[model samples]
Target chain A: MTPITADATSLFDKLWQARLIKDLGDDRGLIHIDRHLLHDLSSPQAFAGLRQAGRPVRTPALQVAVPDHIVDTMPGRGDATVRGGADMIVALRRNAVENGLRLFDIGDPRQGIVHVVAAEQGIVLPGMTVVCGDSHTCTLGALGCWAFGIGTSEVEHVLATQTLVIRKPSSMRIRVEGRRGAGVTAKDLALGIIRAIGINAAKGGVLEYAGPAVTALSMEERFTLCNMGIEASARSAIIAPDETTFAYVRDHCGSPEWLPVATEAWTMLRSGPQASFDREFHFNCTDLAPQISWGTNPGQTIGIGDAIPPLPEPSAPRERASAERALAYMGLAPGQRLEGLPIAKVFIGSCTNSRISDLAAAARIVRGRHVAPGVRALVVPGSSRVKAEAEHLGLDRIFIDAGFEWRESGCSMCVGMNADRVAAGERCVSTSNRNFEGRQGPGARTHLASPATAAASAIAGHIADCRQVAGR
Target chain B: MKAFRKVTGTGVPLGRSDIDTDAIIPQQWLITTSREGLGKGLFSNWRYRDDAFTPDHGFVLNEPRFARAKILVAGPNYGCGSSREHAVWAHLDFGIEAIIAESFGPIFRDNALRNGLPAITLDGAAVSQVLAQLAALPANRMTVDLERAEVTGPDGTAYRFTMDEERRRALLDGIDDISATLAHAPDIDAFHSADRIRNPYYWVQPPRD
Candidate 1:
């Protein structure tokens, strides 16, 4: 148990203190949200509540707005280019400007998915509280911030007061030790964690990710880890910011004359070597392989070479009957091998893995290979900026040359908010998080994997190991 | 806000499942976080494309019979996608009060319940039967009783279903989750006051196994 703050603390204390979590009493902990990011999805209601209350925003500067979904992420464009999607994004800009909030509208060079851009810009500092309407807000926790998703009304409350009345969550520390294999990426690690802990099992719990393997990850990788915490039903996922974090922030946000002062403050952000949690889970990444979800939930996953888990024995008939129903609904056979499952589509984009590094990995796999005949492979960047960077590096050409559709960013196909979608009954190897039934599109079957695996599956037209491919 | 003891509407015929937020209200309309005047953008793309409803013949909202639909009868696995609360708001603005589907996405269901939208799921075949019954009649009338959790169709036939009791109570009381949680504020405050003990050295060292 961590000590509660000696002084009366603000609602956002843990973030301001650079502490993982100080006890807030009972099972709750006082954590902070460093940055409050907004998107079109949850902002409207929040703003509505503020209007109803006749309250003015306490600190608009701390709140930022970006539009990544419900807009077209087409190549060389922003939300404005996507027909009417621009109108909403533009409205956010107007609201931001009028309310004195920071706005990153479509076409802004810095714009992308809220989470991706937050890390890349160094806006997500360690020991900060970051809240957003999007569940993937946990992505910022990788930078050592306590970021998570909130409801629309909660957003309104935070905007009006620059504070949140939150219940302290129980803490759960998950430590992954050892080094990873060449093909095993942060995505695989996340998938592995989800598989170990069933979805919704981590509900109301704060998950702190640590250990040597976590320390070795880049800021991008940490983002991947924290992003999936929501899928596990965890309140938040955090990793203590280290030199790599400091370096990334300095490189992107810039280290100025006041850097030394900020650094001194940042040094105190880590867990004081003695921090404890309510629960702990450990993993040895040395033998971890690229992972994929074969069933309806992220927890129902198997390693690259492993087979799907056979139906578990429920103590009674009714519970066993439900398990059978789940298997049937998921269209999976107990003990069936997960590899070589035929796939019709491959999607690589989402806040989960749409960064430049994610694209680079896919580009490597598709460099000299063509997508399997009859397969539809689409690569949607997380934001316009990511698309631009990928094009700058000619990643679009590589994907297109390999017969994959290099389309716009936005949350395409990841959640079926845009035009991109999987046909009914189609099986897709996707880089997006979540393998929930019909999540991508109605009646579509989703197999969650890393970008490399998705790209490799596109080439092989089946679930294949990315490392087995030539050159990559 | 006037209390709606009874909700009545014409059911729209839509067979598509997992109708995500993007399809409900495309990203193009999400620019302003303002909740005002969202009715026009609701189903904007599907309503008008190329100055004509693209796939005009098959688009559910374009059907002449259900032109003023206020209740949507959809297939299984409805509302599967990003947990944007906007989708529910768009539906409500478009005059939707009750959604009858085979099943619903968890987050979307929660959002709808919070906003007084009733997301009721039934057996897929049962929903198809209700849709067929509605389709068989021209300009069918549908009535949903919030207090009873029942839907009456054109022929005065009633379809009964279940809703999460907790959500039903909140909706009946017109309280969102935030308000519901706030109701326990005094209790939560007491918990904090009574449980302020802390560990001395957990921040710097791992806890003992």
Candidate 2:
């Protein structure tokens, strides 16, 4: 392949400059960006840094700002209920308007989780470099774009220079084969992938999903997989564009440019049957059970009903030390059964698996079942649009009737960013990524699981295998 | 504005492993855009009952000894999950001068430095020892001397550490990196005005192949 190095922008470089790229794939194979995402959390200092540099945003019109992380999840109206959430919305709106960018204010039908709305509105297209201040920006990989999270300074750098300096990442290809097991959704497939390679295995590289199983997934399912790339410690995850992707974009966006731009870029993105990867891992979906992380890290996972791995004889001092420490904090015995380990809460929302599909999965479990006594369960939607769609289908009622709190969208309980949190010493089976200590709150314990597993845990009041309850 | 200056303070011992950011300032607090007074909200859910503003007896922050902690002694892989700087700021706002952990999540540590909070890592055992000492004497004062690259506890036991020399210099001078970047305004203006090329990454490249 001829190296095409044209005078174009890289996504990271554009983030530094805070400018929009005219096109992607300059003859050099580097992709430029059409839009950038700014949020309340990362954009404040970016603006401050720009002020310090005495420059306005390069192309604010191409930028979009929304509040997702800190927004309150309470559904009630009135100033107090919207208190903290409204302030950030006000600040973001002020910032966007001042910078000449578009502001999607709270309550606007267009207002939803940034990634979901971006894909739904066709703002994120195939073959674009989309940088957001949030790491889950990798979700756009489902759209065939190179999107990932960046830092506050990097946000400023992009705003001021519209470019970021970055080294091209090495690549890792994860090929999923065979049809998915009945009742096994994309959440299971993603957890299965993370379990196989370990979270840090894909770090510093771009991971591409291929093979029949991945292609067989819906756009929502693919998004669910790629969206959690950050949780796997990877730089990003991308799925080769296909008819389903084009259809999703076309149907949601309905623009003349969708087909033309998608068709053109999708062709360039596939790993030419002979393309190479720095590393490769393959999985057979047929045998994989609904997966979940029983330990404190996403990598400390096991199949449903499997006991925690006996502390592997530490081949190295670090591994031994880590195992000893993990065992101590989680109050678990090596080789202890993860089943029936009582839980205090169940959280089912995050950029990782909180799409509409995830809701449906949880609803299926919660439909006729009440949460086991004392297990505080909440079902948070990923975006307002997702919430609306689920509500339209009465999915919210299914959960609410089953004693789950149906709340508004945002990264709720995923990172413990807002008021929703698991109490200290409280254990939870969560559908979001990352089970690191205190992820739900100080001294709180997290067990990462799929929506189905989380719902099962809610019913059993512990870590129960979904297949046992959902019945394969 | 005053120049950024190095801050020296006592290290509070938390001694817990895998202390992720979600625990630092749970996600429920991220909704508001206000950066002011987040210290109160930091670890709030754990410290207080859901509807009760008073302290929760079982929570870490509510524990008598750690009520006024200013420095955290943590285990490995601290600050994992979403790159929200709010977690870092909440810690800083709560008067946490430094975090002594086994390691840090890449972006979370960077966010700490940019906001004047230094996340220092040392041997896990060493951190545990510090935690024990702090537990033995809850009010034990430990100083983080950036100039000396050392942290000394109330008992005078010292641990050697390292920080980015540039960031250290900036902190000691009380100036942020962005301010430092701007101090070279004349050079930057000259560079931008020169025959610069735009790279594929959208950054202005120096005029050269």
Candidate 3:
């Protein structure tokens, strides 16, 4: 492989400039999309729009379809398992066949959440431009790719032409220094960052995570970090590709044949010493505790041992109003400790924290104890391959023995699109991304936490810290 | 996409922040492949009272005076959360031609632009003043002029804004994104050839017949 040239620009700029097909001025550019990911919920309308416009997919080979969001994740589940989802599932399958595109259908070994499948199959690589119809597509940015979510109209536009007219977002680099303490994980760090900076801090900007703490995280942990970039309302989130990234991609299924060449190219995909950003932020996770969301939005969070802060005076009207509303919706008062709040259910899966390490973290907590009486617990892997690997490691047995339901892969109970859902009026501790009002279900109260915290909460029937359970 | 030059309509003031798309149109309403009839589902959770389907008169949109409101004025971060375009479709179907907010979610703003609805952003003070003025005079309307890049409130207060020139032209010409993208075919071809050499593995080879 020839030596790749290094540029004195940020990693984002390098990838963005490479994909620019035409600059339309005023920051808007038409960039060629190297990969387009589609799912059952968003792609049906897009495909229908393409058909209505008498257009065909420009590059069918670059597109991959999966039925994750609306598919049932129950064991032995078939296409008809989800109410009102059968049509969507069937439509996705039909569209894939009609367009001659590759699809990881239900029961396929490669089928899983679209983001997980893309990473596991090595389709999303360093320095590539990837777009998807889901907000969590930012997860691919962890692999050093320029990735972001698009609406159905943009999805249709990409289907017709493998390019999108996008405005260049200003860049922000968030540096996290120092080593993380025990019981701290990527989910906790992400929540802590969102709490420190309001949800809109990174709006209209791409966040490049750097520093010792970020580099110390594993590839899956980095995915967990980038997965919630959308929660911060960021255009995307990325990390420079390093040896950890190269090794993960090399070991994943369907890796490219040209490994050495890819590695050499990726080695150059980093920001130079003089690279500048529109804004910069520094966060220290040295003493960070396992974080938890106390209110409806992901930004309304606190460390596990800290009490919820009181709603401040109305001088900052927006903050006061948001805090009051979140408190009302969550049925909590200010200054209350979140630790003893009884939880009716616990979910240990989602695109945010459903990787193998996430399950292992939860498994370690549930190994000897059973879920508290009247509390329901579930463990859903992010992908079918993750499920197989977990079962091979006997993680499923541990979960089941601890009174938790072991389910197949898919976005189960995350968005509540399928039969798996938190019943109305029930409070749940979930490891998913969003904690919006009625996000899990109508009138379902959710407290977002890490996988270990979720498992510990299930055993204690409340929002308990993982350290306490481990101490027991 | 329909061409948009100007729109004049009564503004419905929804003084709320972080109004996510899930609340705009619930996940249950996303069952249809068609974008039609989503207006009925817009804010369905807030519009209706219970399973028996009692109308909630307290909801702002349910008020008789605001029944025909074609403009929506909201607080910051309106249309945050999910990237579902159905939120825009539902608002458009409900006769909303324009939305004025302090800010908007990037994806939602892009979706609105492509769907021919203008998500105009104004400063917080300007939006607050507009909302207060509209609240005092419910019959007063606002005018959004895409050509001039300004919004005129009923009291004749004007808020200036800016948009991408290409998107502005595409919206004015009523041209879909596909047509706009096709105009750059030559440039796209050039980039594709160079990109193929630089990142060969990024391309997925077609399956053999």
Clashes of each: 31, 51, 0
lDDT value for candidate 2?
0.70
lDDT of 1 by residue, A353-427 (tens): 999999998899899889998899999887667788899999888999899888766777876645677766788
TM-score of 2: 0.74
lDDT of 2 by residue, B1-209 (tens): 12333344445555554455666776656665445677877766556766456878876556766666677777666676667777877887887777777667656776677677777777767777787787787456776777787777657888888766665665667664444344444544444434134222122111111
Residue B185, candidate 2: how far off, in angstroms?
15
1 against 3, candidate with superior lDDT: 3
Worst ten in a row by lDDT for model 3 chain A: A250-259
Which of the two candidates, 1 or 3, achieves a greater DockQ against the reference?
Answer: 3
Task: Give the best candidate by lDDT.
Answer: 3
Model 1 CAPRI quality: incorrect
Model 1 segments more than 4 A misplaced: A1-33, A76-87, A314-326, B1-83, B86-209
- Superposed Cα RMSD, model 3: 2.7
- CAPRI-style quality class for the chain A–B interface of candidate 3: medium
State the lDDT of candidate 1 residue by residue for B1-209, as single tens digits: 12344678788877654455555765545545466566666666567654343535556777777778888888655664456677777888888888888866545665677677888877766787788887787757888787887888777878787865655666777764444344444544443333222211111111110
Local lDDT at A190 for model 1: 94
Query: What's the DockQ for every one of the candidates?
Result: 0.11, 0.20, 0.59
lDDT of 1 at B122: 76
How much is the lDDT of residue A326 in candidate 2?
Answer: 67
